[model samples]
Target: MTGVRWILMPLLTSAACVAQAGWIDEAELELRFDDNLPRGQLKRDIKSDMAVAIAAEGGRGYQLTENGRLTLTMTLSATGYRQYSGLDHVDAGVGLAYRHKFGLGPLAPEARASVSATRLEYRDDGRDGWLYSAQLGIGKRITERLGLTATYEFERRKSDDVADRLLPTVAADVYDLTSRNFTLGGDYTLSSDYVLSAAYTLRDGDIVSTTLRNLPIFLASSAIAEDRVFGRNRYAYKMKATTRGASLGVSRVINDHSSLTLGYEYIDSRAEGGIDYQANIVRAIYLHQF
Candidate 1:
């Protein structure tokens, strides 16, 4: 009887230990490399840029009910860009994500929202711009490794000097723009370490500009001749454009805390009632998790 009691006590202790162990939380520090290889009309006139970004994020699970759980995450990123013409810029931003899961049947619904702000400075021209964006998304998981997500986003941009400063003649041509975008996407997770995804997006926006210095001599003279010249000769112009695009990508988890992704994107834009413009982009991203 004494030997049996000893064996039973050990078995009970092991069970208690197992019951106390729960899922572990995750935290990581990520460093990312973004290479924007440009193709199309802008390729010959503009140089491509490279950016390095770093982020730190953590996630923890909370019990919502007997069979439901929520995961909350917050992240901050700093990105710096270098252009081929020796131009450089830096931007910093923050974001938050929340995911909830309910153990009902085979599908789980999730929602997410994020916002960020960026400041861009041109090293050669001493010019800068501010850009801000917010996005919200809702999605459902079809399986542990597959899902569909739909999102809406709004973005606004303002710039100080986008055109050549030396050519103040065209400086008035520099402008600011605001855009609103809607997108739908799906993700297919092949495994714990690999995923493939695609998305279609539509963007509509308007560009606004004010006079920088003065109108060209010919236009100025014409205005003067017409007796419509003001002291400053200021003018405003508005342009509207629509863009549609698709992206395809694959991501691989290199290790417990690292990932690499490659993607291709195509975009077609047309000025309101104008000609169409096409752009192609190839990008490679490396992320490090700590």
Candidate 2:
């Protein structure tokens, strides 16, 4: 969160400040079960786990134009894992977003651009990092009941330098990562209080796979490190991979300020040397807006 926070103030000061004088707050609690938590390339190393996360955010909005507004938000979250305490962590972040619409009706096309930076502290020190990301999105209403959106994002993770390298040829910073992603999604209102949504995402990036020493994977990996979290004799390998994922969800509005969601997601990732893995996840979430 080094530079993004400062940029938000300058944008707000240039705006007309027509928005009302109250902070917007949002809270969420989520429980998730993942069939492949470690992203292991081998069946023997695959691990499953359950996790819970809670998050809260607050922000203020400023009107920049007749059809555009900017929001500055601060967020905090904590997550715990049932099977792997090494993945438990806390994070805090700041974000800024600007949104604009083409016209004044429900069917008007809308666009949003946002940037954020977060500091994530993990139980495993090697996994700690500063995550920075930027995203641009556009949305249009296909009908009164259906809407579609597309988004593109780029992100980077910067972490501590590793002192102990498992292999002389392997890179030292195993946790440093970068990725680009594109997503397409659609949502349909089933009723006044219920909605269904589905999305597909394609990502190209660096992935860390934890498993036993596999010679073929070594040829495809860029980094290597000892991963003691899952147990002894396991290692972490960093490799370039392409991932595709799909998710489906349904949301139910509880009242004016609260809602609940149930979701399922599946992901498949393939590395350069034909090393691959798959994951399935299910989630339930409760959210409130204030």
Candidate 3:
């Protein structure tokens, strides 16, 4: 966390060098509820939580000689989760983008890249880790009210405990892995005060399955002696999986600074060790932007 602070200070200081820098341009506060907090595949393993988050972002752009602008933005967010507080974290990100306008009104293409870091603190302290991600995306506006975007993302997460060492029969079950994701999204404004959004995502990566309710069969398959080493509820296996999901949301704008969104998401994941499962999530978000 200290290192991140040091990095952000210099970026904030450098904003003064740009003419169009809005040092503190926009801020947002959000409240959200998730029916499946850990993205659990099995219904029996699902847990629910509510989160409150606050974020602030600022940007600066330089006008190009042609019809484009180069921009840099910095964003910071802090969030707290309750019901199951172990998944609480803070995130910070910085992005750089280029936008080209075609002289035709309301038509623009943009390309962007960003890097972010997250630190998770858990009450149990077993699943805590630092997660880092990088993303690249491109978007184009087809009309004044509609836009489309495609993005590719990569992430790496490293946890503190070694699961293999804790359970000898498990095959290197450490909760550290790399993942890749590709997403296509679209948004349409139905009116000045309402917007509808949808997205589809495909992700391939490694995941840890912690809540195996059928402990005896799972243990026998892994060639491990039945011991209480994993306790009643703990992560037991690491496997490669592919997850595909989609989301739909409708947002109603209350004013310039406030809005409400209702969303639903569905995901199906297939894992290597017969841990395939599906999950559905419904959430509501209340956001205030300034």
Candidate 4:
């Protein structure tokens, strides 16, 4: 929080310099239930947890030209889990974005690009590092109450420990991976105060899975057990995987400054040389605009 505040102070101090400005300053509270919190593919020993998160962000946008604008934002968030202590984490990030509107057809088309950097701190005192992401998106407003968007994103995540390798096994690096995501989404206004949104995300990347040493693994000669597993570390092997996901959400506008949202998400992961699993999640969020 201190690091994020230092970055935010400069932006807040300079906010008065911009003219004809539009700004966003909001706080978000979310409650989520995860049937499978660990992203584990195996059916056995699956853990469930409840999580609560609080986040705040403030940003300002300045019109650069008739159709172009630049925006900058800083955000801080922390999440705590009821059962999974290892999943607790805090996040602080800054984002810079640019958008341009094209007045071509009846519906204006918009193009967007953004870059962000976030610091992640874990409660377990391991697997902590920064994540960097870049996104490019195109969107069109089809009607007064409907919009569609397609986006592509690239992200890189690093862990504090070394990555696991096949030979001369080192088990420290299970949290490190790079991912590319393609997403298509749409939002529609159902009424004066209600909205519906849905999206499908396809992610291809390297994933990690940790499981116990079993009989099938001994026959295949493919398993590598970590030294710390038998003693302290509960998870042993790190297996790579791919994931696909989808989400649906409905939001109710309580007022211009506040809203409530309910959402559902599904994820299917296929692990290489490991187990495969599916996950379902339900979440509720409240947003307050300042």
* Clashes by residue pair, model 4: none
Q: Which stretches of candidate 4 lie over 4 Å from their true place?
A: 1-24, 104-106, 163-167, 214-233, 236-239
Q: For residues 1-290, could you state the per-residue lDDT of candidate 2 as single tens digits?
A: 22222322333332213223334387677889999888986789899988877776778899999999999998877777876877877788999999999999999999999999999888788898899999999999989999999999999999865748766767867788999999999999999999999999999998888888888888888988888888899888889999999999999999999999999999999998789999999999999887
Per-residue lDDT of candidate 3, residues 47-142 (tens digit): 666666556677778887477777777766656665444444555566666666555456667676667666654444555677788888888888
Candidate 1 ranges with C-alpha deviation above 4 Å: 1-83, 96-106, 124-127, 160-175, 206-238
By TM-score, the candidates rank as: 2, 4, 3, 1
Clashing pairs in 2: none
lDDT of 4 by residue, 1-290 (tens): 34334333444344323211444387787889988765554565356777777777878788999899999998877777765556567888999999999975648999999999999987665557889999999999889799999999999888665545545644445566688999999999999999999999988875544445444332333334342312344454444556889999999999989999999999887764455678899999999877
Question: What is the overall TM-score of model 1 with all chains considered together?
Answer: 0.60
Write down the lDDT that model 1 would get.
0.53
**Which residues of candidate 2, in runs, are more than 4 Å off?**
1-24
Q: What is the TM-score of each candidate against the true structure?
A: 0.60, 0.91, 0.74, 0.82
After superposition on all CA atoms, how large is the RMSD of candidate 4?
5.9
Question: Which candidate, 1 or 4, has the higher lDDT?
Answer: 4
Best by TM-score: 2
On lDDT, the leading prediction is 2
Better of 2 and 4 by lDDT: 2
- Between candidates 1 and 2, the one scoring higher on TM-score is 2
RMSD of 2: 7.3
Error of 1 at 229 (Å): 32
Local lDDT at 233 for model 3:
53
